[model samples]
Target: MALLGYARVSTSHQKLTAQISELKSSGVREDRIFTDMMSGATDEREGLQRLLARAEQEDIILCTKMDRLGRNTSDMIKIVDTCYKKGIAIRFLENGLSTEGTMGKMVIQILAAVAEAERERILERTNEGRVVAMAAGVKFGRKPHQGSGMALELIHLDTPIKLVMEKTGISRATYFRLKNHQRRS
Candidate 1:
């Protein structure tokens, strides 16, 4: 039975060095390590998809943390259930836990719930900060282009759309959107 390792980071800016090192220390080969630089909330990760497809009976899937498997409690439970059914075991290094027996399963369930609660709390805090910023008159989206008015003026003067875009550094989509807005006005 092969020991497989999976590492995940929320974005491209984050590194998987620590997790990879831990997995390597645990005797998982570099080639057997799968990684996803995407949100744990989504299961559509390419690396995860490949790992799940390649896993077989008696194969052990190792992760640095339980959250690396998934953040959603229901999804985590489903994954654990599927692994149990397939005779594949999951091991979380941080918690020193494995899906091996009744007690392990119980601990996994509790951890999954805690992980999900933590995720929700994080979301709530982020939303609260955004609301506070908005109340303080802070705009959250992209600032209007400094040359937007110039682009509109050029359009009104019958200048070519491509030239207007080049002069204003505006994309074709944005130019068209402005044109449509003008027409509506």
Candidate 2:
């Protein structure tokens, strides 16, 4: 079995320099490293699936931290348990723990608990924010009639929807919906 490394960042804008360096320093080869440049909440990551598929018994899975692997405790535990049952082990660099020992198991459990609580708190705050926004007539995310300046000018000039889409990069759905919305108002 090979020593596999996994790194993850929440957004595409972030770089994997630190994670890559740390994993390499820990004796994981560059070719054996797997990385996911998406949120920990998403399980459909490319490098993550590759690690899960390629890793085998006695193989080591190195990560920066527990949260980098996953946010929800249940999900994290489930993933870890899968690795454990498969004879795969995990090494958390920051925590300096390995799933090969009892203390590491305890630490992993505790970290997972804390991460789960953090996820719950985040969800609660998000729900409260949504409620406040709704009461104040504030819409979250993309809103209709929020076209670009150029698109607005073109719409006012009675330009074709296709032309507006080309100029503003707005999708066809957003274009027609915004056009009809402006006409109605």
Among these predictions, the greatest TM-score belongs to: 1
**lDDT (10s digit) by residue, model 1, range 66-86:** 889897888788888888889
Tell me the number of clashing residue pairs for each predicted model. 0, 0
- Candidate 2 per-residue lDDT, tens place, 24-111, comes to 9999999999998888885677888889999999999999888888877776877888888898999898978788766666678778
Estimate TM-scores for all models: 0.74, 0.68
Model 2, position 16, has a per-residue lDDT of 94
Colliding pairs, model 2: none
Give the CA lDDT, 0 to 100, for residue 149 in model 1: 91
lDDT on C-alpha atoms for all candidate structures: 0.91, 0.84
